[model samples]
Target: MTKSKQTEWNFDNTYARLPKSFFSDTNPTPVNSPELAIFNDQLAESLGLNAEALNTEDGAAMFAGNEIPEGASPLAQAYAGHQFGHFTMLGDGRAVLLGEQISPKDERFDIQLKGSGRTPFSRGGDGRAALGPMLREYIISEAMHALGIPTTRSLAVVTTGEPVIRETELPGAILTRVAASHLRVGTFEYAARLGNVEELQVLADYAIKRHYPDIEDNEDRYLSLLEEVIKRQAELIAKWQLVGFIHGVMNTDNVTISGETIDYGPCAFMDTYDPETVFSSIDVQGRYAYGNQPLIGGWNLARFAETLLPLLHENQDHAVELAQEKISDFSNLYQSHWLKGMRAKLGLFNEEKEDEALINDLLSMMKEHRADYTNTFRALTFEKHDDTALFGIPEFTQWHERWHVRLSRQQESKDSVNQLMQNSNPAVIPRNHRVEEALEAAVENGDYSVLGKLLDVLSKPYAHSAEQEEYCAVPKSAAPYQTFCGT
Candidate 1:
């Protein structure tokens, strides 16, 4: 069932053909004894590739960077970022974009190999990734996709049959990541630093063509592009908040122009309904905490606007005024999207003046009682009010009465309300402890059953099946969970 690599690849490398200044020409360094660890056959099929053709040793070699597929021109993109409120140069240090794959449905996607090898931007670190973290990204990204979040997809994870030294020696792996494009806010920042508007204009025109094609011919296209990007970020962050996802690192580099979630490193879903949840071990200051995501999103967009100010208007004063006007809209835009989502999560199809208060009040109660975020929502979705953990409280009893009264105002049937809540609230998430267990079993004993089961349960986050029941059990330990940016 294997086909020639050229025929199945369908690459049209437009990015590689872009101006040479945007990226460094570098192919992935070959690995030793490449072997496939996991292949996403379903994702492959969705991308209009022959799954059987790629589910082979040859495919493993390509994924491992031991064999370059035809039509692939690998390159590392250059960019700069404000990492934790401090400006610095950054780029794809250990990653290389193979090329854009043209799907049967006429959609284009960037097929990049992460952990490929050292690039020009490698700054002083080893250009390699560990097997556990690669697998972790695969699991969490796929889980996020299932939850209806816009995110870069994992095509495969190939073990290099080599070891990488992190804190200790670990098995090496390469992740084949598929994305809309690799353009980030930092990319524009890099372009703006060229000491002239020519490079910046080129980048802006290309970005508008690639992402906001409809706005390409608009008179105020540049400003419109900024607004569109702002709108997408607002909507994207709202989705993240609705699911309780803490990005842990909200640097401008990670804010994609395509508005898709990239870089799964150090990201996790909230277990407890606490807004100040910070999971990254390095985030001692609660800067990128769960509650701070929307604000950070706005800050990142403002940086993007700063890069586009010259293009936004001819006059300096007018451009500053225009940029300020659009950036200010992020607040109302984000609140609209977030409140709408929060309302849906509560099964309130219609808006009311007290909706925000109701939502905030429930969150307050959950925070006070330390209710498991997923479990509390699932309890309400299933109408299990007798569940003592959330329901057996005098304060909550009052909230419950108010909630029911709110529900009575709607004409929607009980079944409809349940359906909305069920769809909005996931029954399971990639719980940190369970994820650790899966990764440990696979990396230590070469047993993938635990990981496979977790993937299966997570693939349908909204489904309340018996398989999900065990996975949904709240964590027994109260110890704070910490995540690492291993990639």
Candidate 2:
């Protein structure tokens, strides 16, 4: 179909050009009297959008599905996933991919309207989303970007002038999410269900061209793609652990092929340095806990490999052996990445044979002392002496001495040590209390200033500011913090 050009959108919808079987041609359900909730102006410009022109009511209308953009071909992607280890059929239930937006710098991104409405995959519930959860995603995703983590970006959130009936009535909102691409492990799983290697090959080719174009000419591009994805995920999960970010839900569907964090449901940053911490109320098994992320990452990759078996090799047993070897390498890759990151966090400019033990010993002390994770790192970054709460512990003091000796062995100057730590460790994070406070103010009081300020601090996570210290403060209560999925 011929379409008019939208100057601001600049959409080049390659995803829609794919086979129709890959997605359902669907449009977002229109909402009543849509209003602009929030817009990421900086992100808009970076995405090569004409931010000024679309920063008004028209933008809200576009995001709220009241007015589809000229270049947009709204559709819901089809995918299946293993939810908490249980295989199930699922897809975009309340979201629609508008199209891929090509930026001026030649970067391609998938622009999607999440919580737009229901589709063929909505299952049996209202395909609507509440404002609070949408705002939470906006805040956390932006925070993740600032923390230098690969994640889906939030372009805008528009409030629908209607109440969504959850347990009780709640204000509705829609999130315009931008991503490297929405191709996930679940997509492969869904394609495998079609019972054809050609179908899977097409999807694999599309993904490789979009994300891993470098590997296209390889003799074994399929296996190479799997290895590349596995490595990306290993590095990605290590970064998550370093920053105390718990994804809460690590189901195969949520695992993106681009290694970018996708869904933000029930996600939060840890407070104290405890390996057993789990905030997702639904994660009763502690499957995706702070310590279990790397394992879950490997598990998810194995699922992805299973879908690619036919493409990997003609002999099923040989393919299994190849996939297993690759999966086995995940642990070493993850450990190497995590250890390297931990070294930077510790200001260890040079590697020591005992570095792993040193890092583990400190972590053990932190857990035993119930010390705040971010603050302890920040204090160590500054080499501050005022943190009696953590430094006062005898076990920690001994650990500090060992770390001091370790630092002493390095030829680098003290300034170098501090610089490395400052660069590696964030001065601020999207602390749970702070996030909740911002969401509460915006959703209940209609006060966005709280949220804006939090974003401002989060934007410069490494640079220390006196104002950032407020956000760095841990929640007063030691009560078990809980997180619930938006759905």
Candidate 3:
């Protein structure tokens, strides 16, 4: 493969340095008539790439699997995960890590391509990605970043000029995914389960240096790293809950050790305030539902702590005890983070002893009236009007009284608080109905303008643009929507 010189990938592959057992050495299978649909020039520049070069044919070739770029050490990572509560061994079934790029800010990010093509880890499945899901990922991941959550950023989306057969024939595409690191809780699980304690230690040390470098000198560094990850996961789920995001899949493998949101399969933001909002078609039991995310996140972290038992202490019994103690802190961490986020959403400048109860009252009213979750917070951005007009429930009047009383006690000006709430709450999300509408337009009519326009609105979610009011509104009753797992 002829590599490009203008793009300096600077592949400092520490994960690749591990035993071959950790990953399968492979290259992306080439695609036909590769075309560039979108490229993130700012992200490329952050990774020290010439934005102009990436827009050229040479860039399209590299991104489309026609050629592997220089300094790229492509491989399929190995790991074990508990999927939907079932423990199993899995790896990078359809994704390849192209290489790592060091940013000008002295941060390292993995440059990977999803749906590039088949590899040993492909597992008898086509390595190609459907255009709808690729675009959905690009949209949601970028929105998560704009919302100030730790998440993988989409670098590019390339068209393969081919069709992939799923439930029906679909346009094929590839996504350039960038992450702080692809290491996950399941990575440590794989090493520990395989009885490679030495390798587990090596992985732990590498993670600490790469992510939690500030705690490297701690005597119990590995355990401290485990604790830090648990705290981050707690805070992350809290943020997701505040924004009404259902991750759809909380598998250990999808949980990034760097604490960034990873996969976007069957994910959806809530329209109505149902505690059990589930969008993933495969989640029949509501295991990964909106209300269950925090519990599932804790479950996933417990599995991670189990993998680090050996490194927590010398004695097996002592290690087990210490690990359990650290894991127990997840609840406190989650509660604190959740309350903080909820407080912000309510535009509460001062935390009172009854703040939790005040927030719960509003949520209960919302749930009873089936009010729109996003719109409720958004409406709160304005003065408390007779929201019963919007909610269409007389009971909401009582809740409004309680909210006004709470607000009157706060010293901050309502305008200032409203301004803060406006920025904190998004006017637009990657709503399932809108995403489906965009996908249908693109697939059925070859129109990407709708998808492009939706992405533009979601990219700056907090900004109020009267031009996008149609996009912000909940879909009409006629536009019924459903989400499906890409499996």
lDDT of each: 0.90, 0.90, 0.84
- 1-487 per-residue lDDT for model 2 (tens digits): 2112433677778878777778999999999989988999999989877677667787788889888888788999999999999999898999999998988898999999998888998999678899999999999999999989999999999999988887789999999999999999999999998887788899999999999999999999999999999999999999999999999999999999999998998999998999999999999999999998998899999999999999999999999999999999999999999999999999987787899999888888788878888898898888784552577777777888888988899899999888989999999999999999999999999999999999999999999889887887887797888988888
In model 1, the runs with Cα more than 4 Å from the true position are 1-7
TM-score of model number 2? 0.98
Worst 10 residues of 1 by lDDT: 1-10
Stretches of candidate 3 off by over 4 Å are: 1-3, 384-394, 478-480
In model 1, the clashing pairs are none
Per-candidate alpha-carbon RMSD to the true structure = 1.3, 1.7, 1.9
Collision pairs in model 2: none
In candidate 1, position 445 carries an lDDT of 89
Question: Which pairs clash in the backbone of model 3?
Answer: none
lDDT (Cα, tens digit) per residue for candidate 1, span 1-487: 2344533888888887667889999989999988888899998988877788788888898898887778788899999888998888898999999888889899999999999999999998788999999999999999999999999999999999889998899999999999999999999988887756888888888889889999999999989999999999999999999988999999999999999999999999898889999999888999999999999999999999999988988898999999999999999999999999888888999989999999999999999988888888888888787643777799998998999999999999999999999899998999989999999998998888999999999999998888788898877889889999995
